[model samples]
Each structure stands twice: as structure tokens, then as C-alpha cells.
Target chain A: MGITRRSFLRRAAVVLAGVAAAGAGWSYLKGLAQSANEAPDQAASLPSAPVQQRTPQPHHWAFVVDTTKCIGCGKCVAACKEENNVPEDPHFNRTWVERYVIDEQGEAYVDSPDAGVHGFESWPVNSKYQNIQVVKSFFVSKLCNQCENPPCVQVCPVGATYKTEDGVILVNRSRCIGCRYCIQACPYGARFLDPNLRVADKCTWCYHRISKGMDPACVEVCPVGARMFGDPADPDSAVAKALRENRISVLKPNLGTRPQVFYIGLDQEVR
Target chain B: MQHLTRPVLLLLTVFLLLGAARWAIPRMFNQISFAIQDRTVPVGTLLGAGGHANVPQDIEAWKARQVQYAGPASCTQCHQESVAQWKVGDHAGVSCETCHGVASDHTANETPLPTETSSALCTLCHSTTLGRPSSFSQVKVHQHAGEATCASCHNPHNPGVQGLPTDLIRPKPSAPLVQHVVVAEANCTMCHGQGRLRPYPQDHAGWQSPGCLLCHETGPTPTLVGASATLGAPFAGLVQAPSVPHVTDGVPSCTRCHDSGAVRPFPQDHIGWSAGVCLLCHQAGPAPAVGGTAVGSPAAGGGGDAPRGVSISTISADGLPPLPHTVVGYTQCQDCHGSDQFRPFPSDHQGWEITECLLCHKSK
Candidate 1:
């Protein structure tokens, strides 16, 4: 019997379909087997369970310096020198007491480099003249402002400087290259190169003390109560409370370092 | 062309079947395998199968696992210095995820993988708008060009120590009198009397009352009695004198002989009596004498007798003629004549040629 064209075509199509179905069934089974074998390896390779997120606790610190209560005494200076081992040169680390005199003539003058062991008598007789007869005379103790956005840190090349979570700018002595870039970058001239360590240094805001739960030495030594320290993040912190109650200004606002050190009675000339 | 034969037809059919298998067999296998594997069957395969099971209901599942967040402390193990400096830094509280996004990949990979972060990561916490005050903002710090960064001068683990010791000891003053004077006053008032008189300590009671240091303490102060005497005889004599005279004369008292010139014959126009007058006497040195029969004397009518070329004018002879005198034709005799000839012209008596101008011209 002769086969028709249509019958032959039908037979060919049926054969092709059967082969395709068999091939697909085999491929699917192969994939499932591969996945099962790899599952345990992937699980074993996973890193240790993620560290538990600690619940944040209430930890705050702060400070306060009452300018009205200060009497321009150099007791704080002496204490700071004794505590911190400040150099004898006025250009170095110890805080300098500045007598800000505003005369009736509306002229303002500042006298510094006067506070020492002998006090004002220690000032050089040949030093430059500083006008004193002003409408008001207040003593301002000048030190590192300890800015939030420290320009010193921003300019450091070796990643030696950094701000703490608690809002303190600090330097690691071990890593510091002593390049002094921070000194020049600081708009307030708060940074000085440490001769002993050969590193750029500034106020740490006493991180050593703060971390261990203590007030800074300068704040403790201020006799007239011209210095204050605290955590700004805590509303109850002394610094935070003062910021809420009084008008405080940071040095060099234009530089935008966001100094953590706040001055209650900062004069225009102080910046 | 040959008569119809069954064997020939069968052979031809076999050849045709083999050719069809070459094209269709592999394609059919591919479609069946794709369908069983949960993939959509190709259109050709579906049409070839007469629409039998063309679509697959069990599509392969693609599972994406949940990502894990790693804190900054994890980075510290490898980056000890950076972490140490950061511990005391204002940015210490900032988290690792805050900058590097999810750090799961970095932690999981055995080999170092390329990170997606750049300087922009720093800006997240450092931007002026987003960061706390005192923190550097990318917008603000960029102005420093490339000089600014988080690690510039600070050690992330140990911020620089400020208000540290300077280790300087002030030197003791050389003069005992200066030390005594400094000790006597609460301020500069002891050496310098109150008000304007304080600045001229040499003016009799001015020295005994108060000195110039009461206000003008920073710069040069008029030598007080003790200080002047300690400085030497010249300064002491000048302090004792009423006013400091021209270089030709001995030094004069700053305020004594200088009272408003109304009482004295000298021109009231002396610039030294003006504010900052101490710069005159205490200047580096005395100026040369003007038209005197001294070292810089000018000749009469001689072309060379003009005043010396020095920019600063010296003290003029008080009683001398305005110039073109009978003895000297020119206002400045030193212009034309030598000191020797001019000395005799003025009646070289009292050893005028040898006498120093300062000795005679000294203010009384």
C-alpha cells in the first residue's frame, strides 16, 4: 500500500515531539539534583550570625564657664600649667588669660602673655602697650575651642585626627606624622605643634578623662567658674542646658568648624 | 526515468528521513528540555508539538537573600589606626553602614573585592548640611581644595592633646631696678603715673609720680629715673634734662624743656613733642646736625654747601640768619664750604671745630 503525503508528515511530527519530551524530562531532573547538592555548601559558607544591635543607653557629658563669675585671676592658668606641663613660651599649650578692655571711647584692647607664676608681674616690661581704660574689662581664658567640625582634622593627611562619637576632636599620637597641617588649617590658631612629640596637637577636650567619666582639668581648675563641659546631645547636660538658656557664640563662625567650645561672652575681637 | 520500484522508493524515503532528523531532532530535544526545566517552550517547538504543553506552570524561582548590615567596629580590626582615631573623634558615633552602604559583601568575600564607595562616602557624614556643627561638610571642606580630610592632623583613635605643657620658663630681667619697678606696680601704673603724665616718667614728678608705662607699656617707654640710670649716663642725663636737644646738643628731658614751646625760644613746631614723641629721642640714633660748623658743615656761596642729601633734616641753628647772611651767601653754608673753613667763619672759638655739636646744642 502507498503512503500519502499527509500520513508521512504526521508520523515525522509525532516522532519529534516524543524525543523533545524525553530530553526535557532528563534536563529538569539533572538541575534539581545539582541544586540539592550545593545547598549545604552555601549554608556552611555563610558568615557567623550578625552581631546583635546594642540598645542605645543614655550617656551624656557637658561643661559650663561663667564669665560673670570670673575675676581675671591666673589661678586657672597656673593649674593648667601644672596639670598639663605647659611650656613656658606663650606660643605653646597652656591657656592664656586675655584682659578684654572696652573703653568709654568704644575702643577694645586685649592684654595677654601676662599670666604666669608671678602673674602680671611676669609680663615683659618691654612688651607692646595694651590699652586698659575701657568701659568694661573682662578676663577671657583662651584655649582650644574643640570645634565639632575641626578644621585641623579636615586638613590632616595621615588620617591621624578624628572626631569622637561624643563630639570631641582627637589625635592618635602613634599615627600622627607631625606635619602641622592642622595648625595652619585651624582658623582659631588653636592647634600647636608639640615640640616634645613632634606632632600637631590641640585640645582633646580631655578624651582620656571623658571616656573614663571625668571633667577636663581646665574646667576643674577654673577658679572664677569661667569654664564648662558637658554632652550637647543630652538636653539635661550642662552644656546643653546653657545653650538653651543663654546666648553662646563659637569662635570663627565663618570658618564653620562648628566648635564644641562655646563662649558666653565672646567679643568680636576674640574670634 | 526507471520503472517504479519499492526498494528504490524505500531508500529515497530513508534518505529524506535522515535529512529531516538532522534539522528537527536537536531542536525538538531543546524544546522538551526547556519545558521540563520550567522554561517557556519556544514558539517553533510549540507549533511543532501541535500546542501540547507549550507553557510551563513551574517557573524556576530566583531567590535573593536578605542583606546584612555591619557596624564600623568590624572595619576597625583591619584598620586599627583609623578606628583608634575615630574612637575619640566627633564622627565616632557614625556607623559603617552609614558610609559603605551594606558591608555584607566586603565581609563575606574571602578575597578583597572592589568597593563601590568613594570620597562621596565621606561626604555623607561630613557634609555641612547633614553633619553636626564643627563637622566638615563636603560643600564647605571642598573649598579647602584637597587639603581638607578627616584624618588631616587628628588621630582617629587619639585626637590631639590640646592645652598641653609648653615647658617654657621666662628669663629673669637683667636689671634689678627693672625687676623692682615691675614688682612695685599692680600693673604698669607704678612706673607710669596715671593719665598722660604716666608716659613721660622723666618729667620730674612724672618719674616720681608715674611713668609712660601706665599705658604705653608695650612699645618703648621714656626711660624712667632708675631705668634711665641703669641704661647709662646718656639716658640718665637726658631723663634729668628738661627736654632732649638736637643731636648737636646733649639729650633733653622729654617733657621738661618741651613745654608748649611758648615758654622756650625754640620753635613750638617740634614734631617730637607730638604723640609718639618717644620715637624721636629713643630712635635708632641721633640725626646729623643741620648747617652747623661740625662734621656736615656747609660753605658760604659754594655750590657744594647745599644741605646734605640725607632724607631726614637735622636740627637747624636756632639764632642763625634765614640764609644769604653777610658771612654766608647761601641759606645752607655746608653746601659749598668744608667743616674746617666754616668753623672759623662762625669765629671758631671754644674749639668749635673740635667740639661735638651734641655737647653744645644739648637742650637746657
Candidate 2:
């Protein structure tokens, strides 16, 4: 009984169909496992026990200035420059305050500089727009809004940028491939490419101070006590309490980056 | 079998190709790129490049013309007083560009460019803290409710002296007699009982007594008896040995004993029986007699024989002095007068009293 050509053809087709069906089954199972393990809704509900249960370690954390409280003092910017040894020509690892004033007639005036230590002098002026009776003014302090669900983490192929257990997002400079994905993914425009290191950099939340049980440079030297920091999971913590007591909002909620930084008393004029 | 095998092989190849196409098609179409100066680059870079570097050089040239400016030094010159104060302030080192928008305006304008400012401008630098001065009012409240400007409490010019006044008020001290007791428990009740009353027994009466304070009310215990009582001595007998010995020597009489260079005498011109010496012989007995006429007398009727013809002059009660010795102001008297003279003075006199004078008189 020699095998017929038709019989051989049928057997080959059956083997191919079986392989395809198996591949489809394997794919379906892989997706099911992923869904079961990392359900988005369940991830959101995961107990933030580390923040809630443990004794709060003293940390020199930082805040994302809401642009509302910012009086454009630039005290933070100046202190950061002096403390961090920021470059003179093109400032490195520092922040500055920006002032935006809008008149009732909808004229907008904006001003900023690379630094702000001497003090803002050109305020209390009229807007560029005409017939503006009322003026809405705000000072936005620009810095990193260390996000919990940082898109920078996802895009970093080398796992250089990571979220610490204390919820601070930091970059292991040694591991960074200098791919500025983290910088681009950040909505607050916090990260920047360090010209000297040729790698992406931003505020470190003063990790050195935090390790030694002192406040970050900006928080320590702030004249008016503006930036606040603490574990957001603990209800009694200042950052958490502030969020609870006041009407708070984050920047660019539509992007789905779960930013831990919060702002209070935000004005419509602020971008 | 050969014919069947050929058809089957062709069909299997077709199926594999179809499956690969399904997976690869969407990803290939979704790939995006951008054109830069007629050259192609990733769309990501084209969108991410900030306008500062991305815009054409011609556009940058045009934007530079519209820049506004103001110098921080202009304000520092006019506000010298504030600058001097700000020099010492915590925010002293901060530069002008920090809070103000920029200086392009002042540079462009022949006249000073008008600037816009608000409390919101201050919050850019000042924010809240979790510890120490916990709840900071928002910029709106700080400006409106506190009626304060950044310069009001802080001097941006000098950054020193901050907002604190140079001449601060100093608190005045209370009167001497008023006796300000910081720790009331340690100073007040330990000496004077509740309501400043003397405990009991009129024999122990002193300046601090309820009776004496009725007239002489405004002074610390002045007399030895009064001083001892104010310091809570058990009895007058205990007054000779300093109540607070760690603070001062046992001598209680200020004037009688402390007159310039006079060496205090014992046994001869001593006048009073020393309670310190009495405590040496009569270790556990009741407090021995001190400074009165009855002291040093033999205990009635021959039980302890009195030494022959020893007439010791007792200390006076009305602040008068006892009779002076012929050898005036010597610390010891018996060196000149022999043991026979000491025997004549008093028997049963414990050896505790200083008897040798020459032992201390070699230099004299």
C-alpha cells in the first residue's frame, strides 16, 4: 500500500492546520496570563502599603510648584544654582520662575530668565493687550513633577530611569544610554539633556540631603516656605493632607501619566 | 504519493506567507518619519525639539527684536535701605533674574519698562514644608490677608537683617527686695514655709519669724539667728555651724567676727561656747548650749567637778561684745597661759577647743 499523492496532501494540510491552531491557542493563553497578572484596574487598587504602613523615613523630597503660589521670588532657583554648582553659561540642574499676567481684555504678558536670585523687578506693569481692565497674574515655578507612573520608565530601554521605593523618580547615570525618551515622555518639561554629561538629567529631589536626614536645598532655604514634600500614601503626611484639604490638580491629566506632584489654588491664567 | 506531496507543500507555503502578512502589515504602515530640510528623520525628534533650537535662524532673529528687559540693580540702587537689610536676609544671595521675568525690557526701553507682579510670583520660590513652620498660607493669602510684599518682611537688596528690627526691646529686671524666684519650688518653700511663716517654738524666733516680719518685712535674713532661721535651721544651737555650709563658712556674726584682720579667738576671749566643738564630744545628744550664760557651767553639785576659779565671760544678748583678752585677737589663748591655766578654766572641756597658740604664732 503505497501512499497516494492526495493522501500525502491531506496529511500535510492537517499538520499545517494543527500548527496554526496551536500558535493561536498559545497567543490567547499568553494574553490571558498578562491580563490576569496586571489588570489596570487592579494595579490602581494595589495597596500602597509601603507608604502607609512603614515608619516614615525622613526624606529631603521636593514639590512641583503649582505656578499659583510662586511669587516669582526665584529664591529656589538661586539656591539650586549655588548649592548644585550649576554651570554659569548654560544652567544645569536648576529651575527658574516664570511670570504670566493676563488682562481683563485678554492681553497676555509673559516674562522669564535663566536665573532669578537678585529678585524679579519688572512686575506691577501693564499687559501688552489693549483695554485690559483686570489683570490675572501668576508665577509658575518650573521643576520636575516626579511621576509615579512615569512614561520615562517605560521608554528607557536600559532601565536607567527608575522609581525609588519612596516614590522619587531618579536616573542611574551610569546605566543611561543617553536616549532622551524620559525627557520627552515627561509632561511638565522637567527633564533635560545635560550638556556636560551628554545624558538626560533633572532634579534629584536632593537625594544627598534626604539620605542624611536633612531637607532638600530648595525646601531648606525657601524664604516663604512654598515647596512641600512627603509620602502621598500616608494620610497624615503634609503632602497628602494638603491634597485632601485643598482643591488640587496635576498637569496634563489626559496623558495618563500618574504624576505624584500636585498643585493647589491654580489659576486659569497659568499654563 | 509524489503528486500529493507537491500540492501539499505549495499549500503549506501559502498559508505561512498569509500568517506572516497578518502580523507584519499594521506595524509597517504605522511607522512614521519626518522631513527635515528635505531630509527624513524620526517624527519623535521633529515634535520634541524645543523652538529655541528648532526654528529657522531668521525667525530667531526676528524674535530677539521683541525681547523685554529690566536690570535688578536699578531697583537695588533706589531701595538701598531695603538692600542693606536684605544683605543680611536669608534670600540675600538670590539674583534679580530669579523672581522678575527678565531684563530685556529695561535694555530695550529708554525709560524703565513697566513690570507686572503678583503673590503668585512669590510662590514660585517659596512653598510649604512637612516639618517646621508647617502650614504656610498660599501666596494669595500672604499678599491679601497679611498685607505683605516680598520686600515687606524680606529685603531683596541686601538679603541680610531680613525683616527683623536692628534695635530689639530688652526686658527689665525686677527690684532687689522683690526677689524674682525662677524655680519657685527650689527657692521659696524650701526656706520659708507656706505663707512665709516660721515653723514653731518662740526660742527660735528670727527675722523670718511670723512675729518679726510683722514689723521688719522687707529684707533677707540679716542677723545670724535670722539668717539661720530663713535657711531653716532646727534651733539656735545649730546656727553656729553654717546652715548652707557649702555656700559659706560657719561664722554667723557678720560684724563681730569679720572686722578687718582680727583673728577669731577660742576658749579665752571666745565669749560663746562653739556648737561645732560641742558636737565632737556629745555626738548623739540633744543640741548643746550656745552663746548663753548657762553654758560651760558644771552640772549641779559635784557630779562633774568644776575647775577652780574659772570665770568665763559669756556672749552678750543685746548685741554687746564679750570682755577682750589681754593678748588681743589671738586665735589660741592657752599657749601663753599653761595647761595649769587651762585646768583653772574648766574641766570636762573636751580637747576639741584650740589650745596651742605658739603652733600658729611662729611667723608672728
Candidate 3:
């Protein structure tokens, strides 16, 4: 039982390994404890979200755009950018207006220069587009669908992207990893990576404005009253009344997103 | 064996330290962006399983951030000339956003205010597209502008491309109309006296009337005034200008245009009641004879009773929904009507006189 040189070395090694393993184990346990505490806090906070949304109960806000009434003035696009302080880059738009032109042969052409932030001008004098003889032409505005079961929320690894109880899909800019999973998951191409903030950005339905009982910027500035916003659940709400009265369709309904934003006078060619 | 064990042990310790740093550092000092957003995002965001529960509050909070229409008043300081001009012309009542996009976009950045250079710009409100209301100032832009910008020929401020004649004595096929934007500064004769563009009062005779509205507000009917009224018929007061100096007795003095047998083509029902009929429906209270020679000189003993039942076009088909022909589109009622010209308003119509005409004179 007396100490030999080889056996002594082995004993010292085992002691060192034990000490190191314990230190590493302590940190691991600390992490687990913090996560465990956070989970309960998250759960508590999560349940309250839906509750708060319901408190304004029976008031599920929604939006509707009447394509027939839209005059392609670019007022909504300009208003959206000015309201949200979105960067000027065309690619970073939270909302935009697109024009469609169908030719005599039943061919459709679409273009949105600068998201139609500038009102669409007539074709240039004797340009190719003018000669094409557009049989049908119209304008349609595009924004975040704010789906009831949003894939953007589901794909957010950090729970950065989420839905408000009112059904507004919003992003926690701080929590987002900028991995762009939500952007990829959005079926409507509504999501974009804000280059300035380096986070995923999309339409908040003028969340800052709508919450205060004011219209979203886009709706406020539309000259023709084409873009409409209101609570769908409230029978008296404009969107609700419109939905009740008008034939409406949502973009990509087959995906089962249950979008809060609806469209009136939607043409078959609009995607 | 010792040499290998020492390196392996060091490597393991370093890996553990790295893992701890990764979890601990981020957990404590996650992107400050998160902190900022947490404060900004009103509660009830779709951050959870069922989404934002505080729908009422979160949406309420966010609503404040919604963008609003900065009206022409907002742009007055920056665009004095444009707004001032717009305030006066046919477009005076139109929203600046209707043509200029949003005010924020123009004011925030030096994004030059967009100029409307296309036919589409003017045609949005002016185009004679199908399904448009008859009261709207509809125009066949394809036939009119002919690939030219409406602003080129019309002044956006004062879109009086066709100065109307003050009197329309003849039967005009079409009346003079003004639109939002059109030939702004075209010369006087560009449309007025020109043969092709001239809007003659009578397309049938190719003759211009004295003025489209001089004799009457709208197209005249073949029936002379009160031709169908028999003895003692009630005559509703007329809206004619008071300057005509006509008598307001029981009988409507039709001498203004009724020249007895001199004027032919009376209403079918007026076959027997010639313009020469003397004091049949009226009392000779103290006025001149019917269709008398001297103007404003009525025979004595005027004002009589009602023919219990006579066939006179009811003072108008009033109390009925507005008819298509009476619409002027320029009526003061259209000011508050926006696109819905028929929107009911409080009896207290602000500045403009919502005349007796608008009660049934719907705009096109």
C-alpha cells in the first residue's frame, strides 16, 4: 500500500482530472439552471400575449385592399416608407405597389419600379410597352400577410419572429439571429433583411400607428380609399364590414396561413 | 503516456471554457437590439405559441406609430407655389396625395416631388371608363389627349380648356364640361372657336348657342312653359334669375319665349292652348293681358285658384331618387361627397349652397 513513483503519478492525474471535470460540470449546471428559469418566464410571458390580444377581445384587426379602386398613384407605397422610416432601397420595402399589364394574347406583364413609390407614369412616347396593346391593366399592393399560423414565426430559431394576439406577425429585432430562416419561410416574399439594422424586417401593419387607433401610413395616404384597415372580429369594423359585404381572397390561401390581410377585386393573374 | 495525456487534458479544458463563454456571454449580453425592441414592441406580439395575447394593448401601442396623411397644409410651407395653384384651380379640392404621392416621402428626403407627365395621371379621374358614374366628368381620353400629356394642353390649376358661351339658345347635343387636368395654357381659339373641337350648342344645326345655360340650366323640353295648365292651375314659383322682371301671379308669364302663334311646336298636350289664350288659367287681378306687348306690365287682377287636376310636369319628380340628366358634377355637394356623391350630409352644409337642385340632381 505504500506509494510507488508510477502509482503516485497516476493518483495525482486522477485528482487533477476530477477537479477540472467538476469545474466544467458547475458551468454546465449553471447554464441549465438559467435556461430552466427562462423557460418558466417565457411560458408565463407567452400565455399573457394571447390573453392580452383577446382582452381587446373579439377585435381581430385585419386589412383589405380593393384592387379595382386602387388608382396606381403610389400614395400607399410612399406613405408606408415615410411612416415606417424604411430605407430607400427597393429591396428592403415593407410594403410596395405593383402594376400589371395584360396583352391581347392573354400574356401578363408585371413591373414595380421602386415599388411604385412614384406614381406610375404612362408609357413613354411610342415605347415598346405602348405598342404592346395592353388589353387589361391594374395595380395591386403587396405587404406582409400576417398569417394566423405564420411560418415566419415557426421557423424563427430564437423565437424572434412572433404573432401578436391581434394576429400581427412581428419580429423582436434584438433576438433575431439574422439567419434569414423566417425570410426563407415566408411564402409571400414579404420578409426582407434590413441592411441598416441587419435584422429581418417586414410590414408591421403599421403596428406603431394602428395600436393608437390611427390608420397604417399606407392606408392613411391612399388617395382613393383603396387600402382599408380594421378589425375583422368586430362587426362594426371597416375590414369586418367590408369582408362581410364584399367578395375577398387572400394571397396563397392554399398554404393554410389564414392571413388577416384580405383583398377585394383580386385578379387571377396576381400571385 | 504522460506527454499525450497532458495535451489531451489541456485541449479538453480549452473546449469547456469556450463552450461556457459561448452560452454565458450571449445569455447575459444578448444583442442590445433585443432590449430596445422589447421596450418598443407593444405587448401581444406574435411572440408566443398563441401569438400576442395582449392584442388590444399591443395593437393600440403600435397604432400610434401608424403613418398619417400630412395634408396639403403640411406641404404649404415647402411647396407654396404648387399648393397655392392647386388651391385655386379645378383641382383645388383634390388632395395633394391624389397626384403627388405622400407628403412624408417628399419632405423627408430630397426626393423631388414627382411630376405627373403621363396621360394616366389625368385619366385616373377623367377617363370615361365603363362603370363610372354619369355625374363624373368623364372624358374619352384616348380620343381627346391622343398620346399627349393632359397638362400640356390644360393648366392643372385652371383647367378651363373650353370657355363656355354665356347663353345656350339652341339645343346642344353635349354641354360644356371641365375635368381635373387638361390643356393648361392652350390659346383661346384652340378649342373655343375651332370647328373640330368647338362644342356647338346644337350639333344638329352646327351653330353655337348664345350660352349653354342662358335660357335654362339644362336641356330644354319641347313643351312651352305652362302649356298643359288649364284654368286655375297652381304654378310653383320658378328658380329663374330675378332680373327677368317676370310676374309671379297665378299664371306664369311665358312672354320671354312664348310668342303666341309666333312660336311653333308647342307640347302635344298644348294643342288647343295657344300662346294667344288670354287669362284662362289666371285672374286679371291687376296685370296686363297674357303675352302682353310691354315687358313687366301685367294686367290687373292676377293670381287665381287651382285646376283641381291638370297635367303639368310635377314641379320636378322630386322626392324621387336623383335622375341622371340633372347631375352637374360641379355642384357644391360634390365637395364633401368625395367619390360617394350621394353620401348623406347634415342639413348644415358648411360653405357651399347645397341648393334645391342637389336634392335630386345627382352628379355624374
Candidate lDDT values, in order: 0.47, 0.46, 0.56
Candidate 3, residue A68: CA error in Å? 1.5
- Candidate 3 regions exceeding 4 Å error are A1-58, A122-128, A232-241, B1-364
Cα lDDT tens digits, model 2, A1-271, are 4677667767777987787667656654664575466555433432221211235464324353444444555667766665454555434545666666666677766666554553454333322323445356666666677776788877876565666656666765434546678878777777776655545677666554343333455654555545666655667666767777778877677777766667776656555
lDDT by residue (tens digit), candidate 1, B94-171: 444433344544666644544443444343333332102221222455653366554443333333342112342234
lDDT of 3 by residue, B1-364 (tens): 6655676687689989976865575456554232232222222222334333334433333343423344455566667877766666666655666566655445544457767677666765576532222444657776765777777677665564332233522343575653212333323342245544554222213222222112233213333234222211211122222222222223333432333333322222322343223122212222212232222211123234222212232322223222212121223323444223234333445675556434433344
TM-score, candidate number 3 = 0.48
Q: Compared with the true structure, what per-residue lDDT tens digits does model 2 show for residues B227-265?
A: 434533223243232222111223333323322233222
Query: Would candidate 3 be rated incorrect, acceptable, medium or high by CAPRI criteria?
Result: incorrect
Question: Tens digits of per-residue lDDT for model 3 on A16-48?
Answer: 778766765665466457556655543332111
**The best candidate in terms of TM-score:** 3
Better of 1 and 3 by DockQ: 3
RMSD (Cα, Å) of candidate 3? Answer: 17.7
Worst 10 residues of 2 chain A by lDDT: A45-54
Q: Over 4 Å off in model 1, which ranges?
A: A1-63, A114-118, A121-132, B1-364
lDDT-better candidate, 1 vs 2: 1
| TM-score of each candidate's B chain against the true B chain | 0.22, 0.24, 0.33
Deviation (Å) of B252 in candidate 2: 50
